[model samples]
Target: MPSSKDAVIASLIKSFEAAPRREQPYPHWYLEHCLPTADVAELTALPFPAPALGGISGKREIHNATRQYFDAANMEKYPACKTLNEALQD
Candidate 1:
């Protein structure tokens, strides 16, 4: 049997290849199982607090300081982030 990481990558590759390319109402594919259940849970469990937007709606870049992006530092710190990043790159 493949390892968990291998399995997730394989699943993502298969799902992405199978996803249809639609052009009608905006082109997009309905992908499923992009991430494992455990990985999803881990991501949702991250302790990053919500930004105090002060009732103002704007681009996500507005809270750049508060929001944690999946950069090299974050991937090194979060296993799920690393896994998801690798899977996408595959």
Candidate 2:
């Protein structure tokens, strides 16, 4: 059976190839519907920790304790994160 990551990678490749590409100073593609709506929703609904600023302003390094990331651990935990990471990689 194909894994969800494989399925999402196939969809993302197909969408990117089918979308229009514009090459000017740089080569780029405007990919649309890159991921399924359900997957996108799942990512949005993820309960990532949000640190309170408390009027604090600086780089994210300040709140490293409560910081959230899509690192290997999160990618392994979340299907949508893994799929999205795959889509962005070569």
Candidate 3:
């Protein structure tokens, strides 16, 4: 029997591979039901450190050239963030 992780990976691969794509303007596929509602809620609830802005306007790329939103340290700090990352990668 396939492990739960393997089964999910297989399912995701099948769904993504089977989805129709548009190649005219750009190549993109619209996938659905990839993540569960509860998982989404938990991920969103994770306290990812807010990006520090340079000026009054909330622009991350204004003075800060480095565009590091989800860093490795933060991922280790937050399990939900890591879970979301793993789901996206799968």
Q: Residue 48 of candidate 1: its Cα lDDT?
A: 72
Candidate 3 minimal-lDDT segment of 10 residues: 1-10
Please report the candidate that would top lDDT against the real structure.
2
Between candidates 2 and 3, name the one with more favorable lDDT.
Answer: 2
In lDDT terms, how accurate is model 2? 0.77
Ranking by lDDT: 2, 1, 3
Encode model 1's per-residue lDDT on 1-90: one tens digit a residue: 112677678777777888888888998988987766787788887777788889877787777777777789977888777777776677
Clashes of each: 0, 0, 0
lDDT of 3 at 21: 86
- lDDT tens digits, residue span 44-81, model 3: 67665566664567653474654444567766876555
TM-score list, all predictions: 0.71, 0.62, 0.50
Candidate 2 per-residue lDDT over residues 6-90, each given as its tens digit? 6678778889889999998699898988777778788878889577788887786787888878889998888777777776674
Report lDDT (CA) for all predictions.
0.75, 0.77, 0.59
Candidate order, TM-score descending? 1, 2, 3
Instruction: List residue ranges in candidate 3 displaced over 4 A.
Output: 1-11, 48-60, 63-68, 86-90
Which pairs clash (backbone N, Cα, C closer than 3 Å) in model 1? none
lDDT of 2 at 44: 78
